[model samples]
Target: MRFQNLMFLAGASALALSNVANASDLTAAEAVQEARRAAAERTAATEGQEIVVTATRSAQPLADAPATMSVVTGTELRRRPVQDLAEALENEPGIVINGIGMTRRGISIRGMSNEHLLTLIDGRRINDALANMAHADFDLGWVPSVAIERIEVVRGPLSALYGSEALAGVVNVITRRPSERLEASGLGLLGLRDGKGGDTGQLSALIGGSITPSLGVVAWGEYRHRRRTQSPLSPRESELEAREALSGSIIGWWEPAQGHRIEIGQAAIDDDRARDTVTTGARPVYYEYQDHITRAQTHGSYTGSVGWGELQARAYRSVLERVNERDQNQTPTQPTKATDTVFDGRLTVNVFAGNRLTVGGEHRHETLRDSTVNTAGKADVNHNALFVQDEWALRDGVSLTLGSRFDHHPAYGWQTSPRAYLVVEPIEGLKLRGGVGKAFKAPSLKQLSLGYITVAAGGRFIITGNPDLEPETNTAYELGGTYYGRSWNLGATLFQNDLDGLVQTNCVEFCGVRGRERRAYVNVDEARVRGIEVSGQVTPLPALSLSASYTYVEPRDRSKDRELAERPNHSANVKLAWQVADATEFNVRGRYTGKQTIYQADVPVRLDDYNLWSVDVSHDLTRQLTLKLGVDNLFKKRLAESSALYSFAEPGRVFFAGMGANF
Candidate 1:
């Protein structure tokens, strides 16, 4: 059947070629040139030099970066045939994805909790002002993968640059920029599943072109529709799920004079009537959510040679408003809303002596409002920070980086984070890197203003709050190396983090009346996490590629001799890709997650290990058209992606197919 379909596509292409020959004045040679030019442009857009991510808040080569970082281009993301940021990062080493009904969840890196990491879009922070201090989920439901140009994942401590809440790392998403030429493109998918469901869809669009040499604009949008049934044991029982989102952006660059440039851009996303199952009985309960967000930013930078070095200055402001409403049985009792504003500025100079110096400061203020029957909470937070870093080349192929940041919060007084790194390259294609750093996370407003009544022993109710909670702190060290050659790339790293003053809730049964319990925030004496990660990719044949990654982690509470909750001991992923022909390709992927213990109320619960497999195939029907088919969780693994404390389940086996076109 596949071969027959291929034949039909070939015959249709031939017919289209004949028509073009009969109707166009261009010769075969001219047509071939035009195709080559178009291919060249696509290649430039899809596969160019590795993007220098500002993950450190400083632009640097991903490979040359002293810290561990991974780059996933828009082209690479499409190859995997998955939508959503968490899905895209699942295969990356040292990263774990948690799914909450497909739309809400978090990601853990290097054994750290999801809330430990910070997420940013185009250098602007995405703030979640909830009481728990957790960063909001990536909201993949509204993020259009088609508009993503690339994603950068920087592992390890980054508090020196990003301030509080960056104790784990940073994930920066870069959006697509307009091209100089006029162009249009689209894509779609269709497929079926064995265990749960199937789906079919298409995405078509146009983009690129400059109104004038100084001003450029690009606009693209996607419309996708899929039908699938919820898993039998899912929080929501069997029900059809529908997801639709529309997104578009405009970017303008102005080079008003020499050595200076100004950029302004705005993006808007709207998701309508997203449905999900929330189990209330044998039959699945349904809920609908309407989410919308709009973001706008303007930045200006000036660069020029001054004296014996290059000087650069940059300043920008960004605003984000996220509103979500829930409808359960046509009754909207609770509505949540949040707004964030940030102002940032930085300056740097590169000296002729090969020393790079940087200094910057940022101020962020946030306000959150929530209304629920019996519960109403409002809070505001202000954070101000200043940092400076110096990169010194002590000798040939050897360099050292030293940095420190001072942060002041309205609730927490002065705090300092410091870092040091050394890099030595004794030979080509090999680098030795080591670093030590201190990072911290301030108490979230939810932790400060939390005034909710909870049932204690004997059904007694009690309220709790910790206005004196201190910020959590961590000290970490890492050693790593990277080796790259013509046909293979490999990297390995060993890291350790020591946590102090870890904020956790403790239950004191005797303190409450009627033998009830009172929960309050207290610092954990000590905790530690050590891990090693290895990743590599090898292309032995022109049409075949092999890639693999593995991570081993040991996380423990030093005071109790117990493993941390939801910290996997071992994880691995293997993937194989083959180009069947000029216009066709196939991929197979598998992942394994080892067992881990979940700790609650000082008790431990064990979870079993599990594995999952997936397959994807794509075909290019024409210069401007493509098709993709994929099945995720081929075996419908019923493993838990998160601790049972969250009451969320991983998605079961499902199928997806889509197509795309360009003009």
Candidate 2:
């Protein structure tokens, strides 16, 4: 044994000497390329490399991809946050979740804020818009963790490839495809709040199998019900409303020949929410409210390998419907509905040297059957876009990416977005990257053609939209570097974004409802959004792993001389996991959300900073079944403690138990 060990060491030394000898007369990029090759040899002996597609619309190793990106695999997700995709991404750099209300959440990427962050499923857009001008929220929780194979996140303007709405970045949820062999899985979880009205439960299942030698199918279903949670201010009434949601999807795949594939899929969601007397304390005047949202989508695609390259043609039709009802003093029910339809297609070519060129187009038609109380009448708009991108590998260790897009909205006219990116590996394991890009968001028809004016609190204030609005645009750039060590990884980015023609309602005078100011939609000249993001991970021991990230953002509303609403200047997250045994593990996660500015009783208020911690453990009962137990907000800190930025009640220290299995 001793002799064998000596021989191995001598061989390793000789290889190291050869690399050192070759390091001379080598450019930094060349040296780094050699190091990457060496790393491939070392790790290839243990695990397969990770391949990502969203960064450049092509499959490539994450280490070789020339972009600022992060990936959350199914395994890592099981040990991280459990609530939703937004929470799962909170631990990553350049992402933040801003909550407007208990069930209302929006994703902010690199401080661009709101709908600027575009979301996609299997490369198709998921339309998330409502006539409600006050809320631009997107439900990241709609996707159950069980069905997600992995989530690819790219931080920076991607409008050049994805078109309008990617003014900030992009997140693509990649679902697990049908297996060549039979497979099945299920999950059941029981969760509850600490006090009255805080209870939740969920169940999910999925199955996939080959139907014939050339065909396969996969399907998934999930149902979740959560009760209204009580608020600290009104211990007797619910501050956050309760809701129930049901969602599912099915897909069929046909591989009639080698390197040729076709797919068809359909997905739907039904969600219902209410704020009746049962949860809210109200007088005889029945101030009752109910909301129902339904979404349906069907898509198909054909991908084939052709001479000199591969060709992919895809198309998907998605529809979103929303209904809102209100009643007072047993009055008649007043209902408002909004619906939107989206169509998208794309094609890609492997030009040469593994480089790629892609082109795509999309169209969205939105109609408001009955406008909400905030606006007026039936309205509709048609939006269209065309985009192109080039992922050119200039050399072995250096690469450049160029992209551009043109968007034409019937109401907003034609506009363009363009971007450029460069990457260089100066040494093995170290990558330096930077990019400058432009992105935009066209004004929705509801925003441009609203004929009704909002008189809040029975005429205390008024807000209206203008039809002559233009598209909101952004110019951004980022510089970052990442180092991949044998057992650790670290990265940092410095980014800045300048926004123009921001479309939002602003108070003419004292815009606050109580301030007796009227709000109107107008293009605010410009605003500067800038920030720094840093992230790192380390595996000090085979049994233990640690990951953490921090973001420092400064989102200034240059038009109003104030920081953006509900956005904190500093935020961070940390996660630690330890394997106790072959089938057992424990995890601890903590998050820090810094102070944010808001309005309480129509007065400017600064919320107090807060830290939350959670812990969980998972143990395999058998090779096919696993048990999970965890508690969120273990310290029991909640909104009632400090109403500074309180929009929703925190689920105080709740215990949850669940089980998952595979067959």
Residue 661 in model 2: shift from native, Å?
A: 1.2
Q: Give candidates' CA RMSD values in order.
A: 6.1, 12.2
Candidate 1 structure quality by residue, lDDT tens digits, 136-231: 453443345666778888889888878787788888888777656666654444444454543424343547766666656666665544444564
Candidate 1, after superposition: displacement of residue 258 in Å? 4.9
Each candidate's clash count: 20, 3
366: Cα error in model 2, Å: 3.1
Once superposed on the true structure, which residue ranges of model 1 sit more than 4 Å away at CA? 1-49, 99-103, 129-142, 190-192, 195-206, 222-231, 234-244, 271-333, 371-377, 450-464, 508-518, 600-602, 640-648
Looking at model 2, the pairs that clash are 32-427, 32-428, 448-467
| lDDT, residue 511, model 2 | 55
Candidates' TM-scores? 0.82, 0.86
